[model samples]
Target: MNSFFARKYVIQGIFISVAILIIARLFYLQIIDDSYLLSANNNVLRKVIVYPARGVILDRNGEVLVQNEPVYDLIVTPREAKDIDTLLLCNLINIDTVGFRKRMDKARAQSPYRASIFEKQLSSRTYAKLQEHLYKFRGFYVQNRTVRSYPDSMAAQFLGYILEVNDRDIERSKGFYKAGDYIGASGVESSYEELLRGNRGVKNLMVDALNRPKGIFSEGKYDTLAVSGDGLVSSLDKDLQILAERLMKNKIGSVVAIEPSSGEILSFVSSPSYDPNLMVGRERGNNYMKLLNDPHKPMFDRPIQASYPPGSVFKVVAALTAQQAGVIDQHSTFMCPGYYSYGGGRARMRCTHVHGTTSLVHSIEGSCNTYYGHVYARMIDSRGMSGPKAYDLWREGIMKFGIGQKLGIDLPGEKPGLIPTSDFYTKRYGSTKWRSGYNISLSIGQGEMGITPLQMANIMAIVANRGFYYRPHLIKGIGEKKIVKEEFTEKIYAGVDTKYYESVIEGMSRVVNQPGGTGYSVRINGIEMCGKTGTVQNPHGENHAVFFAFAPRENPKIAIAVFVENAGYGGTWAGPIASMLVEKHLKDTITIPKYIQDRIFNANLLPAVKVAAPKAKDAAKVAANTTAGLPKSRIPSTLRINADFSPRVNEDNARVNPLIEFNSQVYE
Candidate 1:
């Protein structure tokens, strides 16, 4: 009986011990495991992120142009969100109830714990109402954010728009980013994103039983404060930008002005531009899509993207190259019976007029096409080489001016205009039989030649400085801070010797200050300017008036390029615009004859904005590549005209409105 009782007690003790161990193990799994811990963390401590304020944008003179304004985003977490009043929320926020429901459903599908914003950029009036009724809703809150606003509403292209982080952008940024963060989409914003975005901050909160955030539960031990983006100081002159924009009203064109001594881009204006304020947060997608499809391409950076034949302005480059190569000197003369005849039976290269017995200087001042024809002939023929060899010489001259390749500008999308090379000819004409006569338009900045306004402006900088130019840049400083970049003082040469540049500068000076010069009308009484006129030919049967100039000759300060599409004669349209820009830069006020300013300010070119569709898309790109500086393909017979096309002669421009597509709806 005693043994039996002892065995029963031992078995009971062993069974009890096993049961206790099992309970302890269950407790460990439920309370100590990471999954359980994560669940607990999700329930009580909601993490709210505080985004830093974006930096303010100011002009070179420290005037604020782009700044951040306070806005609110309506945030929610689906698991905790038992929104009691959906209709009121939708009504207050201007979203249809159906749209509100759809958004909420989508948010719920994304993640139960992840917070999603339903309404972006809530108005002050709506925010006040929500703040009053906030306690009525669960897991619904308002988070403070900022939206970009342009107070002055000028310089749209320079101050690119902001956008939400896309999947691609997030992937590129690695794990540091998520959707809904604002990012710089274009212009200065994109380039300065790192400095302007600042650090992401967090506020950790301890909540009570009711899920209300307790005030500073750990006394800020777990909080990381937000830092605002640094302030920016751009190289732009806002007054000048506005003046240029206004001056260019009603015209399709671009104006690029640079400080010759420093490569500071003072004012860059591309017409048919929209106010950047329209591109932020919720409005961004719609506005951008509209701009993306707009016909006039208002979003296009005309200064850097639109390539035109340098036109007569190209003659300046031809003369300079000739002088540099020793093919011609300032004193060298070419007889112009208003034409250059290669095989003389009947094929004289036509000139605008009969300029007889012209020297290099006179040829430049009068823009003698015949003189360049003779010069081209000498470059290719003097070596007793084939047309390809002569084309190579021409290519060398073109390359010297920073044409045919990106000037490597700090600005995005700079298209290097074309300069022909022998390789290009070989590709086009089988390298066996290609002649210079087949591409004579290149002698006058036409045929396959193309250069952007920024390059055109930089060429003026090169001419003004007499040898080299700093890379054209729009940024001067960041947040009252200077970027110690080499570009600020970096010297870029246009491949001309100093003596060659001086000779060319002298003739350019004569063009504006002398009677025979085409741009004499732009000659200001007290100021001296060296100017060149170019009339670019387009297949649309109209010409572009292009002018490049730098002012006050001795200590050249400002260089400018102006382009007026189909406006006729560089002297008539582009020259005056440049003159006004120069005067504005120097005097801070332009006193152009009011009637002329008003007339040009109101001209339009919408009818000719669209060209015939190319048979293939890459054809234009190929053309641009070939013209800007690709080796001359023995270019198969392409379309071209061979004379100086002075535009707007005897044509009325008062009824023109190139700004037909300034608004996104119409343009896109």
Candidate 2:
């Protein structure tokens, strides 16, 4: 009996030890190790990202410039897409089986179990057809999203466009963005991307054994709400913008208009602009390729990006600086026998016209190079310092007018424009080798000096405001509350005496209204318009036509600048356009001569560089390759206009908008 009891106790001890070991193993599986739990959860749960709608952009007059349109994206999960009807699926999305397989293979390389976009930007009709048969394909689902659409074909450069996020964008987003997500690429879209993109949401979902979504997990216990993006009220005037586009059509330069009082951009036009719509939807890649390959560079934002010699416009700066420096005054006179002879009368700077004796006012009105040449020399020699020291002071005074620096306009890709310092000349010519005579071209706004059209417009605004200006910007307010930033509203003063602006304004006013003024042909009948014209010297081609102006001398409302590349004298092409644009904006109608309007409208000033469009066969190949899911109805025309506003088709077949697209819904 003793022996039997000892064996029984041993057996009981063995049983108790086995029970504790089992309990410990269960605890390790349930709590200590997370890998198994994570794997199990991955197989049973799905996290869906909810993208929010981008903001709508509107003109100051409440006309929609940019809005959102619903587009469908076909998403697929490789793990659950087994046994799909490959042929039927390909036919449904308008793709070949080989293309479909290639897309799937590429997606699988990215991730096998993760969901990715298989086809993007399906039209509404395609979406309708695909939605019905989506259930047939187990792992494929249709997601409704929005893409940007332009209501009117205007402001292509400054309005900008959106593009798919790449690896770099994903890394910069701190996990906010992933592959297939869209982000603003340039222009206002890029500058205000945060306010325009809004917040994304996430929804936790339960999945079946096959990795198909069953329903919302725990009745959306962890789901977040997607907030719609804020809306932007821009300072652009739709009517003025349309008119500017019409005037600049077929040209190769830029037009910039500003409101003097508010410093709001009224119209910004870069000619050879592609239709903003062309950069949207599935064809963006091909359209972008065409624009990029074009030699004229329609994608290049000329208003803020192209820096040219300010030409005679810099004479305005020269006059202002000279008066402020006490080097020259309104009564100061210089004799111009059609040129200024310097370097012991060996080197001469020629003037276009011979004004016997030119004063400050007459120098501007007649655009005499000799008068400014003398004034610039005097200013450089005013202070009893070295040429470099005086040049530094002169540059400082010029920069106060917002030249040689970024104007801080709310746009991307703005060139600061070159305003060379004393050191620049010193380095180029060496410390002791150069003098004022060597750089005399700068007196007439040539040589190393460069300025953008927008900066030129800002200079006009400063003159109109009498030494004060607001930073030029695109946005006026944001969201429903109409909130405007204080920085945009604050007045920035150019450090020049208010007393001197009148003399400059008087000279500019004579430039348009006076009988002998160079800009007399562009004068309006009933308006007191102040203006200046410039012929930028271009060594490679014809001179560029440039002009800037403001209207109604008392309490000026509008200020503008126009630059026409390789278009000859400013008074010929740029002056009329700038004056008519002013009339259209201020009076809402253009009463300018019909012959003048027609001449501008019919001119084509593009360089020899033309972008060749893809051939019919090549376009067909692109259609087959890039647009996998989009139907034939959604594909844009293969033969389209290039950057110079020249068409690939006959003039009869060329697409044209009416002269006016504003104040009428029919324009849409």
Candidate 3:
């Protein structure tokens, strides 16, 4: 009986311990812990997003290219926005009642209890006016933000523009972005987005039942500060870019200038371009649609997108490749009988000027068609190599000069210009049937070759640097830390013998400085400029004019390429413009006569050639119609002669348009 009584006492002690533990837990939960109590009151908490300031963009000279201005986003919670004067609120925001209801309904569709944007990107003046009447409109508030502004009104394509993030952008960003956030859409703004967009922050505050902020929750313990983005220092020369844009105002083409030593683009201009400001604010969508619909394609980035035959400017490559391949040298000589007759008299390639027994230098100076044709044949059919092997070697040499491939510039939408391979010709005309003579047109930078203006400038840069160039880029520096990317710092070699470049350089110098040279008319007084003029054939109308040049023979500064569509001879239009730019950049002032400037500024070719679209169907038809008896290879793809024909005009009525038609079966 005593043992049983002891066991009972032990069980009673365990039960007493459990009862005390339960009482202690209840006191801790009800009296000491308030975390669960706060969570239970969800309507009293509010989360606010703090947007960081976007990065700024400046030119190489530290001139501001892009900046930001303070703006506000008007937000509203539909459920809490009751008992408000709808018409009064509409008048304060400068919107009609219908517009206000539309915005309200749009916001309500997103969420009734949660806050959504009713209006965004309001200017500081508008925000200030709305601030006075905000208290009268319940559940409505203003969120601080910034919008991009271009102070200089230039480099619209390269500087790029920003737009509100779409569903694709937000989904790609995961939790880092929302619908209202802005992101870079194009140009450098899009290329370096990660470095330019900074981290966002958040803050939590206590709110009353009326949706009014009470105070900072937990003494601001959950708040985080926003960090501003990194600034970018671009490689562009603001003054040069402005001048190029001004010069190209009435024309349709592209101009690209670069610092040969650093590969920094001094200027990039595409004519018929729209103002960057047109892409800003509420009218951006409408303006963008208009620009998109325009016939001239103002939004097109032509410097790196539009490709054209290099024309006679390609002779330098032929010369260098000839020397490198051990087929010709500076002293090589060839005779031209005004035309090169090959393929048993079935083929004839004519030269504009008779250049009989010419040296390598004279060939380039006069842009002798026969001379380069012979050299190209020798290079491609030399050293006992087969036609395919020899042609492949020549093409590889050409590619080294940054042709037939994209230069890997920092900008977007760069095209890899075409360089027809031996296989391409062999496939088109079987290996045994095709020979060096079948591809003679390539000697003078014609036929299947197409290169962009950027590539043209880069090729000139390679010549300026004695066969090497940094990949062309727009950005020079990033952030206050002054960091630059490694690719820009690295040097790329053009894979040619340095000794061969001197002769080519000498020939280029004479093209501008010596009399009888194609570019002699464009020579400055004492700049020692080296240049090449190209009169590229356009299937549509008048031939396109092109000029590529670099100044100061020894240590070149600026290397530029200018292209003027349907402008006839290169020296007539392109040469003068390029010379003017070179003179202005080197001397910081133009000493050339005012007559030259006035002529280029007043000249307009768009009206004459506006109706001629670049149609490939017409090219074959024109070729077949114009050269009936000549073999396909013999009939030159581009008639590289001066265009002196005038468009037909009505003699009876001055205002009546003339009708001159070319028969598809015959040329009249």
What's the CA RMSD for each of the models? Answer: 10.4, 11.3, 11.0
Tens digit per residue, CA lDDT, model 3, 150-251? 988888878888888999999898877787999989888888888888988888877654445688888888899889899999999898888788777778
Best by lDDT: 2
lDDT of candidate 2 over 501-538, digit per residue (tens): 88788889998999878899999989989999887756
- Residue 610 lDDT (model 3): 34
* Candidate 2 ranges with C-alpha deviation above 4 Å: 1-46, 204-217, 610-668
The lDDT per prediction is 0.76, 0.83, 0.81
Rank all candidate structures by their lDDT, best first, as comma-separated numbers. Answer: 2, 3, 1
- Model 3 spans > 4 angstroms off: 1-45, 205-219, 430-432, 607-668
Native-vs-model 3 lDDT?
0.81
